[model samples]
Target: MIQLPLTPPGQTPLRVMTIAGSDSGGGAGIQADLRTFAMLGVHGLVAVTAVTVQNSMGVKGFHEIPLDVITGQIEAVASDIGVQAAKTGMLASSAIIGAVADTWRRQGMADTVPLVVDPVCASMHGDPLLHPSALDSLKSQLFPLATVVTPNLDEVRLLTGIDVVDSDTQRAAAHALHALGPKWALVKGGHLRASSQSPDLLFDGTDFFEFDTARIDTGHDHGAGDTLAAAIASALANGSTVPDAVAFGKRWVTECLRAAYPLGHGHGPVSALFRLNG
Candidate 1:
């Protein structure tokens, strides 16, 4: 009998964890993150921070998971299956943020894994998603541990007290945010201009990368920021460097927006599977 050659051990897929709220509408939050990870060919794991009763129109209501439960979920994922990179969105309370930071520190995973903080404070329809008190905790604890923080203009204003009206102001705001200790800061420009092109600024401590894309003039963009940040985390988990990951993420989100399909009565989600069909 001829002996067959034995196959070597299979390599594990890049694992990414999303700590965020659940979007029942499946347009944003954990749902969007998982979809983005799947599109990027990575294993997506989730630790839901809260559950929102929402639809395309607006958030109806929300129930935040207790701090201990949040901590347990993070611990369960990090200690057992492990993660290459993690991204957080919609951390509802100051207690939750504090607990999450503590758990990450205790696991010694704070320094090893790349953490992307989306700082999702509110919904697309002007409803608050995070508690007002959580801002201080996020700034003090989570920001310092983040590998990258992806914040929109309003979020940047809230975090750094800098109102970004133009490109120069955006640059100044990015620099100020970077000074808070995150290794990199991505200031999203989606909310900035409707007439001009949309440009996102990425600051890596010393240098700046201005990513400009033709703004897709469409109403089907409910979860664009969440998708962008998740794509970045997925790229990082797949071993892409910071700048390359951000670049690819920017391109991916732009495509998603360009290829978006209107789903709901109001703002719709981007087509996360656009690349799959390409």
Candidate 2:
């Protein structure tokens, strides 16, 4: 493992920006991202794309943020506060995704900053978070600009039209997703119920790295994806390469799953606060 002091004495904490949505439930979206960023000892910045009426039960509804305001937040932060790496989650519409892509490119961050795209299309309870029309825009604009695109199994099928039943199919899906333009495609097999373990496949067009863990037995994993992506972005901001960053994220998130707790009356959230307990 590539070890570095996360918060060395007397140095500024690196900044990591998350362009995502607000979860009233507070288990996922911007809430989870910021929590993960802070846990990793990085400055957390936000460009909130939408506000959702959701809870541990599920998403009831959402209202998208104005495109201009979304872009403005990105500008205000990158221009002054500065972001070393960024990630996206729960963009509600094609318009928002396209605008985010355009704004990031215009700011000259398209190539400079590493971006983790967590394609959050639906809530864990099967409630849709993204607009129906936004899928194409997400792929056409945002995917091309991502350093690494992390997608759950459902998202893998949505992105590549492949059903990931095993490691073989996951690899195929990774290849198909890589063809969409991200430098890396991480196919998360957390939902692969047929398997005894959760295996994630990372492909960089030429090479493949696999990260897996014995599945934590819990229904309270609401923020796992967001937390993982946020951890990856945090590592990138702290100067880790993409592969190392993903590895770090996997380890951190696995620990989080071990500490997940029930919330509300339904499925709860994966605990990003796990480290605090340790």
Worst 10 residues of 1 by lDDT: 1-10
Question: What is the per-residue lDDT of model 1 for residues 1-278, given as tens digits with 9 covering 90 to 100?
Answer: 11112223486677899999999999999999998887777778888899999999999999999888888888888888989999999999998899889998998988899999999999989899989988999999999999999999999999999999898999999999999889999998988873288889999889999888888899989888899999899888877888888888888898889878877688899878776674
Query: Residue by residue across 73-109, what tens digits does model 2's lDDT show?
Result: 9999999988899999999898999899999999999
Q: Candidate 1: list runs displaced more than 4 Å.
A: 1-11
Cα error of candidate 2 at position 92, Å: 0.8
The prediction achieving the highest lDDT against the true structure is: 2
Per-residue lDDT of 70 in model 1: 89
Query: What are the lDDT figures for the candidates, one per model?
Result: 0.88, 0.90
Using TM-score as the measure, the top candidate is: 2
Residue-pair clashes per candidate: 0, 0
